[model samples]
Target: MKDLKGKVALITGGTKGIGYGVAEALLRQGLKVVITSRDENAANEAADSLASKTNSKGAVIGVQADVRRLDSQKEAVNQALSTFGQLDIVIANAGLGHFGSIEELTVEQWNDVIDTNLSGVFNSIKASVDALKESKGYYITISSLAGTNFFAGGSAYNASKFGVTGFTQAVMLDLRQYGVKVSTIMPGSVSTHFNGNEPSDKGAWKIQIEDMGELVVDLLKMNPRTLPSKIEIRPTTPPSK
Candidate 1:
């Protein structure tokens, strides 16, 4: 991490939003990057766009992977290793939310939220832990403030993020002895397409995707002895309630 140049990173759900932003930041820092999306076309398009925008010292590639399936995640890790020869960072950024009162939430909706937001994080780490250990690398998961706070209609989203927060903390303990660092980032609100929201000028008050990207870069560059295991970020201000 001292040089960052030429290090390799594998990011889940990197076609857009936070994942895409993080990929761009890492590329600018001279780290080769592999971004995955369930949609092959989106993944390739995003990679091409990022390559065109950044005068990166490193390179970027796109892969088709689904975090919900362990095999898919494993394939992504393999692709990264085959393409870049090493994997130094893994970001579990793919996530989704389904909000509704418990009574109104369907079984399918609950499954979708848990599968993509919680189980997905597990799959990402499980797939890349060995590569990380080999490189003495870093693993980061994108959680949310809802992980610690709860609301009436946020049962599914809350449960998944809460799981992510706890899981990442425990994984940190498990991996630190091997010289791998683990951390989870929890953000209150961001300008992204999550839950069908559009990113636009109206959301200027919210945390920008680039802000999250910067945080990840900071974490990766932090001194090896220091670990900021859990971080919670929120907008500086919000409109009057």
Candidate 2:
């Protein structure tokens, strides 16, 4: 961690949004990255774009994998090991939201949200825990402010994120003995395409994807003796309601 050069990271749902941004940041820091997406084209395209935009000192490759399935996650970890020779970081950043009152929420929506947000984190960790233990690496999960704060119509998302926050903290305790670090980032009002919203200038006041990327880099560079287990980030300012 102190010396990040050539370290390997496996990021789930890295084709765009926070995952893509973090990949770019790690590449800029001279780390090799494996970014996964369920879509093959998006994954490859993102890898190519990141590689082209950053200096060649750090390498990046994209693989197709779904965090919801343990087998798929295992394949992604295997791909990272085969290509980069080691896995030092794991970022579970894949998630989705479906907002509605519980009375109107569909079983399908609830399943999708829980499967991708909660179980997905578990699959990602389960797939890479051994590799991380071997490397004594870091595992970071992208939860949400919703994890801690609840609102009407946020039942499914709130449940999943709350689970993620608690799950990650417990994992930190479980993994620390092995020298693997674990942390979760919960952010509010980020400018990205989440839940069908598009990113544009209007969202300039929101937390930017690059900001999340920077935070992840800082976590990676921190002293090994210190661990910031849970972090909540929000925009410095927002329009007056």
Candidate 3:
């Protein structure tokens, strides 16, 4: 925690949402960042933009990774390790949602949500375990309040996020002995294009993307002895009511 200048962070699904916001904050803090996107073009674009803004020597690198696959996650780690040597933080942020009634939700839809939201986190941690251990760094999972608050149409998303919360807690205990801190951030209603929707000005009432970015940085600055294992965030005011 002495300096973030030379530290490296690997963030998944870092294009146009909370992940990108975190990348921007880390870059501004002078940290080297590797941002992954499922699409190569988007990843490269984000990396270049970050590099220009950060102006650190070789500050940003991007890789195409699909978090649902272990091989893709391993490849992302290899890219980070080969380019940056050590990983100081790993953010498991890639996720998707498909809303429907339990009776109406298709098998394919359920698997898609679970694979990306839950299995993706598993892949990310498994991939970076060694590098993070060597650096004694941080591991953060971007979960959702859906993990705790389940609604009628959120069956798939709720199940996956709930599992993510449970898994992250158990993994925290396992990694704590190795000096790695694991935590989960559960934001209630973020204004992001989580389900392939476009974010508009009307979304302003929800939590802003930069808020979670600030939260991540704050967590990093906290004392190492104190681990904020689970954080629940909600919008201060809801829909002017």
Model 2, span 1-241: residue lDDT tens: 8999999999999989999989999999899999999999999999999999896433999899998999999999999999889999999999999999999999999999999999999999999999999999999999999999999999999999999999999999999999999999999999999989899999999999999999999999999999999999999999789
Per candidate, the number of residue pairs that clash is 0, 0, 0
* Candidate 1 wrongly placed segments (more than 4 Å): none
lDDT of 1 by residue, 99-195 (tens): 8899999999999999999999999999999999999999999999999999999999999999999999999999999999999999999999988
For candidate 2, report its TM-score.
0.98
Could you tell me which residue pairs clash in candidate 2? none
Each candidate: RMSD:
1.0, 1.0, 1.3
Off by over 4 Å in 3: none
TM-score of candidate 1 against the unseen true structure: 0.98
Model 2 spans > 4 angstroms off = none
Give the worst 10-residue stretch by lDDT in candidate 1: 52-61
In model 2, what lDDT does residue 17 have?
93
Ten-residue region with minimum lDDT total, candidate 3: 49-58
Q: After superposition, how far is residue 176 of candidate 1 from its true place, in Å?
A: 0.2
